[model samples]
Target chain A: MNALWILAVNEYLDGLRNRWVAAAIMLLGGTALALLLVGSAPTGTVGAGALEISVVSLTSLSVYLVPLIALLLSFDALVGEFERGTMLLLLTYPVARWQVVLGKFFGHMMILLTAVAVGYGAAALFTVLVSDSGTAGWQAYLTMMSSSLLLGAAFIALGYLISVLVRERSTAAGAAVVLWLIVVVLYDLALLGVLLADHAQQIGPGLFSALMLASPTDTYRILNLTAFDSVGQAAGIAGVAARSGFAVSLLLGLMTLWVVVPLATTMALFQRREL
Target chain B: MVNAAAVEKVIDVAGAVKRYGDKTVVRDVDLSVRAGEHMVLIGHNGAGKTTLMKLMLGLTRPSAGRVRVLGADPATAGAGRRRALGYLPESVAFHSAMKGREVLAFYARLKGIAPAECRSIFEQVGLDRAADRPVRTYSKGMRQRLGLAQAMLGKPQLLFLDEPTSGLDPSLRRHFYGLIDTLSRSGTTSLTSSHSLNEVEARADRIAIMKMGAIVACGTQAELSRQAGLPIVVRLGVRSGSGARVAESLAAMGKIHRRDEHRIDLFCLGASKMVVLRQIAALGEVVEDVDVMPPRLDDIYSHYMENVQPQ
Candidate 1:
């Protein structure tokens, strides 16, 4: 346990000193702030809450940026250590291999969590101060922040899995980018293609929901845009939400599963690795 | 539950073999190091010195036999037992973003040592002045010192250092061996691998020479020199006019190699060195000077490394 904390703290400090974590925070905050100020201008004329509209716009932006940031942050975690020869020395210490994996996971997750909270929190604060938004708007904003953190964590876990499976950092980097493309862009496009081809109307709502739940990016989009009625209507996904008949708890659970499965597999594979 | 004095061998490897696919890197070999012993492993590239060290450190398990360090199988040893072992890899590295002080503190914490002790270690390695700087700015010598300092954390009972002095300056290499000697006096056993034979010649209490994935010879320098039966050379600096006369006087003593008019080298076995030396001494004014050279660690190493049969 002590070893785990030591390794985790070391990794976190490494991230801070490298300035990548700070860059990620600035990027998220700047983009979210832009969405809040410009994208939500029509909300006041329409008589809708400003934070609700900001949530809808931010979710769309986050689906692309958050996963990319997470992958960039963690794609080299294990393979970089191996290449630098640090992992060989580290394993000789008193720490177990699983502790090393968990410790790095915690550290990377902390960076992502902090970036999401501070970035989205700053944007939400601006909305609350400049606009007349109710408790419902605040609640939807908070859910968006937490769910965005979960989404980033799921990708971070996937990146770690890639790091452990590959022998070289270049291969891991390529694999991470390819993984992001397939899950974030190609998966949804393929789903649309299936829908377009199914002109006979054979695919049911249940199958569609199951397919969406399979990809973490889709699960995150559904969770943020459809969890609240105001946000769902503002984002124009209320009809899909109603057709799917999914619960908020189920989507959150699926995102958590995305984090667990890949991370657990990374630990198992890392333990058996010869380096 | 076992006392230090009760265990004769700090590290024991019995018929250990390691195979990756069809290639056997470490053959069936047995090696044992006593407590406080300084054992140096000398071999050529890909001769399995590093692989054997990995097997004993538990980083890689042997395919055929067992390895025990500090009275337990290193592969299955508990974390508590691991705290007693320290290892410095061939090319040790740190997170480039970290400062020197942070790197030591991080490893210290993982080893269950107090972070405060890292300050003195920096001083010990002459890195205190640069401790606050990022590791990316460090030179190769500084990085090598940092590797040594980290391996000394908590004064571990056993140390496995691979090419520990590869990047160190000559003076620092001397200090490193001095530190190892001090640790050995205080009951710390060290198993180090090196390609620089002369650097470890006077430092290693026992030497293990490996060839073709197996230990071909293991003993002290004198014992190995004796076992190898390599000839010692006696060079005589003769007067300008006495070279031929001196060579004729010592013709029956040993084989002679004449370099020029002034010098002739006599090669004789260890048993006949005294007789050969006395024969030259008896030549009186004919031989101007006599220089006796014993077989060096390099010669013994080559004798074993070259004469071994392919496995």
Candidate 2:
């Protein structure tokens, strides 16, 4: 158990000191700053609740940034140990092989948790100070930030699954980045384009909603919009989409599934691997 | 608990074979070790010593035959057997993220040493000062010391050390052999593999000379010399200009090798001892001092290794 926890702590430290973690935090911080300074009250725009805007923006921020960081954090988990010959030390211990896998999974998760706390915490603090919004917006922003952390953790585990599945760190890193891009960035883009073209009229009710929940990032977006109905009213289509089925409870369930399933897969693969 | 009498066979390897693709790394080989003995395995590079150790540890499986470590087949050895044996791998790296103390305690826990003994064990290993620092900050020798400490865990009955003191300096190397000797006296069986053949003869009670996946020779140092049909050379130092004349007379009278001007190596042959002494006295007055052994292991090893090549 000490071995397990130590490994986890090391994984967490990797995230704290890693350049990728800094980049993700900077990207999120910069986006929050830009949103506060640039995105502002339009002429004659009424009913702009600070609560609604902050919630919507944070949801967007975490969905875009957290998964990217989480993916980067987890992709090199086992390969690095194997390449550097530290695996021999771990193996000499009488600890069962399964413990090693689960321990590593927990360690990488702690790192993901730390990253979300630091990056999202900074964003929230910045928004509260700069945004002219009232207490209601701050409350909504906090809620969005908390849920986004949950969503990010799910994908970080997903990256761990990929790392264990691939034998090389470089390949795992590439696969993780590609996975983040496809799932977080392009999945919504493709869905939005398809919905606008013809699928929006042709699809069954809640079909797009069902497809969107397939992605934890999309589920996070949906949860955010629905949590702040005022934002749902303004953004029109996307706002309404966010307000629907993927509420907090639904997103929680999906995110939990994301965390467990990939972590389990990684453990299984790790147990059977030669190293 | 095992009966003390049954410990004569510390390690039993029979018909062991390992193959990677078309290459047979280790072929059918049988070797055995006994209790309270310091056994050294010596071979040239690519001789499969490392592979054999890995097989014994169950880090790699044998394609054929059985390896019984401490009387239980390593492939089928339970947790109990694994706990009794301490293994030091060739490249024993540490978890850099962990502090030295943390690493020691962690390994101690795995070895199932009671928590109360952890501090003493750490001190015994000479890692008390740098214990709090992360292993990433440790020097290479420090890391090797830590590896030694880990192998010393559980007071291992059968210690398998692969290049155990590779990075250690002379003083530490002396300290290491002292530790091994102490362990030997305590009745802990050890099979130490090293490339330094000359070095092992000093520490090992018995040396198993290996070449190309087979044991070429196995016996005590004296037994090996006798097997190689060579004499154990004793150096006799004499005084002044008479040393050279004494050396020549001794050589003419009996079997001897001239090492230097003042020194002559005496190899007793099929002759009476008084004859050699009389021959020495005939040349000049005998020297007051006598050095019995003059580093005979190297000469014997080179003789045997060069003479016999394992198929």
lDDT (tens digit, per residue) of candidate 1 on B111-147 = 8899899999898888999999999999998998889
What TM-score would every model get versus the actual structure?
0.94, 0.75
lDDT of 2 by residue, B112-231 (tens): 786566677667667788888888898877888788787887788888898888878988887777877877788889888988866686688888777777777888887787778765
lDDT on C-alpha atoms for all candidate structures: 0.88, 0.72
- Candidate 1 local distance difference test against the native: 0.88
lDDT of candidate model 2 versus the reference: 0.72
Q: Which ten residues in a row have the lowest lDDT in candidate 2 chain A?
A: A39-48
Which residues of candidate 2, in runs, are more than 4 Å off? Answer: A1-3, A9-52, A118-151, A165-172, A186-216, A219-235, A238-258, B1-10, B70-85, B95-99, B109-127, B132-134, B223-296, B299-311
Interface RMSD, prediction 1? 1.4
User: Every model's DockQ, to 2 decimals?
Assistant: 0.66, 0.25
| Candidate 2 chain B weakest ten by summed lDDT | B269-278
